[model samples]
Target: MRGMKSRLLTRREMDDLITKPDLPSLIADLENTPYREYIIGAKGRLDGILCIEAALRDNFTNTFRKVQDFVRQEEAERYIVIFLHRWDVQNIKTILRGKNIHVTSEEIASCLVPAGEMDEATLNELLKQPDVRAVVDLLATWKIPYARPLTRAYPEFLKTKDLAVLECALDRYYYDDALASVNSPGYNNQIIQDILRLEVDVINIKTVLRMVRDRVDPEEARRYLIGGGRVFDERKLGSMLCLSSIEDVVKTLANTPYRFLADLPESSIRSQKISIIEKELERFLIRKGVGAFRLEPLSVASVIGYFWAKYNEVTNIRVISRCKTADVSPDILKEELVYV
Candidate 1:
């Protein structure tokens, strides 16, 4: 067997460089590619993330077979290529989910992507290390503006398993770094700024909603609100706080560009700690939000989208199987599911 060489790529260009790759015509059939579209279109409902995730689990069966086929065809290194730095926050959450439920080390193994900057073994080590501080330390190798933000915010995270706040902090941290990295003086790349900022806008609204439901003070809520803006200015955030009931918060957000989540249940259920509805909402949007960013002819947007979608698919499968093992009814499962 010949040795396969990996190339240094900035997410977008890496797809062209995968070992024993699929042909241009084949990959181009992305629209006809059943699962992505299946995922993209399903984002309308509350369970849209679940639906995409279900589709991913169903599809991963095929991906597994493809890996099997790769070996049969003597192409052993053919696997999903991922950009880990961008999605490390999601990875941390997924790992945390597994550990929280007492999933054994070996059983929790396959869900990992194994590509990207962070090593799987290191991440697994993070799971067993205990507490969010350990998780932050394990990620010390990340070495970016994102790493520092999370590092700075870790003390607060250590104090609370308010998983939503922890999650919001990490996510808010990661994107802040991404935004900083992309903001070059010469390059007027509006697309890069747009995606990062829009993501922040979305997360801020969700965070604010959940915080309001939690009765978190406006001052405290400010901590969870890291960089990325233009949508969620002081005026909007203050206005959101002024609204009393969850219904009014929903209505107030509707008047803004953030009306996307206005349809989701804004009742106290939105602020749940354990279920952490924010992840479900975020996972769904990131997967199908192909056009929101301006990368073309297969670029960074596709790469980042793939990273988000891939993890959601893995996490979704994990949730479904857990439900299945517990013999949860389809109806109850459906209610909790981010369904395709």
Candidate 2:
């Protein structure tokens, strides 16, 4: 709202722009290898950033199609726009990481979303540049000022394997910015706030759990806890830590919205099996997001719903692909799958 001069699509406007005719046409266009073409469109337009359209066309063909029917997409587009923002940032995140660690340019290139910010030339150039600092510099030309945060934070992010710090910074910055104007006239979108709260909360909880398991000090663990997720607020997290066993953990969380995971009586939890809990909770979030999208189809709710689904699709495909590439057993891969 502060810096972006471009118009954001209103619910009514989104309804008009994305129609039945538009959906199938967009979907049809996505059939082949348009990823490169998307890269082409997104690259030089770094300032205006058409990556959102690219992402919607590339990754969200089904969602775009469903919405284009004009009956279902208004809600989908709410997030359809923002998800483009988020996933684009995420792609830049991974690419930056790969570049920092000196992962191959080709290898890094293969993982791009082509819909977010990076264009092929700039991304290629950034990848070819020496390190993370160069990547930050390459993105310096961006009109949306938030890219500066990553540029500034690279040193600390390098010192700590705390990629989440950068990610969390981006996350908090994004929602804080997106939700800042929610109370303004003609813009009463609370669903974005609510769902984002849950997501951040889940991430904070997972981070705290990982830190504890990784043997980071309690003080450090406390430091790592993000202050405000729907589930893991400071108070909730304090109570959660007092529980000794995973059963106690499950039961303590049983009363909260997250209690859904505990409803599965047979799902056992060993400390080492915490990833299982993480997976189940994540799937629960996706399912919940989908339901929310259906309920509030034309608002920010639908956008988030489609966003979550698209993310799951991309992540699932990546997981399956990586497993296939690694020649892992189906049994093991199944264990790692989120089943969303």
- Model 1 segments more than 4 A misplaced: 1-83, 93-115, 127-147, 157-169, 185-188, 260-288, 292-323, 326-340
Candidate 1 clashing pairs? 47-338, 47-339, 50-338, 50-339, 51-338, 51-339, 51-340
Residue 209 CA error for candidate 1 (Å)?
1.5
lDDT of each: 0.51, 0.56
Native-vs-model 1 lDDT?
Answer: 0.51
TM-score of each: 0.57, 0.67
After the best TM-score superposition of candidate 2, give how far the Cα of residue 9 lies from its true spot, in angstroms: 28
Per residue, candidate 1 scores C-alpha lDDT tens digits across 1-340 of: 0111121122332222222123222223222444555444444442422444434544544443343444443211211221245445566766655665667655555454434345556667776766556556666664533356557766675587555555666676677556675676432234556656776776666767667777777777776775667567866776676555556666775666646555565554445431344654564566445343344523344333433444444554345445554666645544553422
Residue pairs of candidate 2 with colliding backbone atoms:
19-68, 20-68, 43-119, 67-73, 75-297, 75-298, 79-303
* Candidate 2 TM-score over all chains jointly: 0.67
In order, how many clashes per candidate? 7, 7
Tens-digit per-residue lDDT, 56-133, candidate 2: 345444434344355344443454445456656767777767866779877776566555444456556666767766
